[model samples]
Target: MFKQKKQQELREICKSRGVSLTPQRQAVMRALAARRDHPTADQLYEDLCRQMPGMSRTTVYRVLETFEKLGLVRKVDSRASKAHYDADTTLHPHLVCLNCGKVVDYQDREFGHLEPPVFTDDGFQIVDYAVTLVGFCRQCRQDPNN
Candidate 1:
């Protein structure tokens, strides 16, 4: 969807969730959707501030957490300490670059078919999962010059 439509939908989502749709929240979503870097709250705050010179870091982090809680975005933690937000909310997996830490979504039937073994064995609820394939991207794998 276009930014205007997506922004309107995001506003509606926030309203439904009882979150006040302040311009800071709107700008956070816009900054995320505008790029594919999987930026953190700090990165978002920097960008948001460039446009909205008065935006706060705390608000950016809070809005992103709110978005995740509403299922408007996916939160992936490729490691223990950091969380990455994904805009595409669908059945998919991740191809993560170990060198630069870029995450790209990879969707396939093979991945879709793998049910959580624990669900059947121990009767645990399986909501969703990200089947990760970690490796270096082409740019990271290639030498700068021949």
Candidate 2:
């Protein structure tokens, strides 16, 4: 379950941002906030299908995109082709299980403070980034079937 305080904060942020807190969007937000596993838009739609029978895949994708734009969610970097959504937008790293496509949050203060590598000839501006460590998760590592 999502923390009550966090949910209230989200509601207030939505109100301040002038984003309509529609039922579908609210449901999606709750779903995202409740889980640590970074889920794709399709996964969220499937999870909410019973509760939001009328909701469409397009709506879920749009709402996630909007939330990402508003800084309410983070679009996690993944090896998988599908985009993953994270409600905890704080700067942190992620552990991606290649076998099962699971994403778990990893927070290390030291890691957050590490400076990026210097770029010279490329002249590319270094911005913010989320570190992703990819490997098999416990379940996958334990089960050869995976």
Pick by lDDT: which candidate is best?
2
TM-score of each: 0.80, 0.81
List, residue by residue over 8-126, the lDDT tens digit for candidate 1.
77888877888888887778888888866566677778888889888888888888998888887777655525677766666577778777777776656467456665465667867
- Residue 21 of model 1: what lDDT? 82
Q: Which ten residues in a row have the lowest lDDT in candidate 1?
A: 109-118
> What would the per-residue lDDT of candidate 2 be over residues 84-116, giving only the tens digit for each residue?
998887778888999988888775645645677
- Prediction 2 global C-alpha lDDT: 0.83
Candidate 2: segments with Cα more than 4 A from true spot: 107-109, 115-127
Q: Candidate 1 — which residues are off by over 4 angstroms?
A: 107-119, 144-146
Given candidate 2, what's the lDDT at residue 27? Answer: 87
* Model 1 TM: 0.80
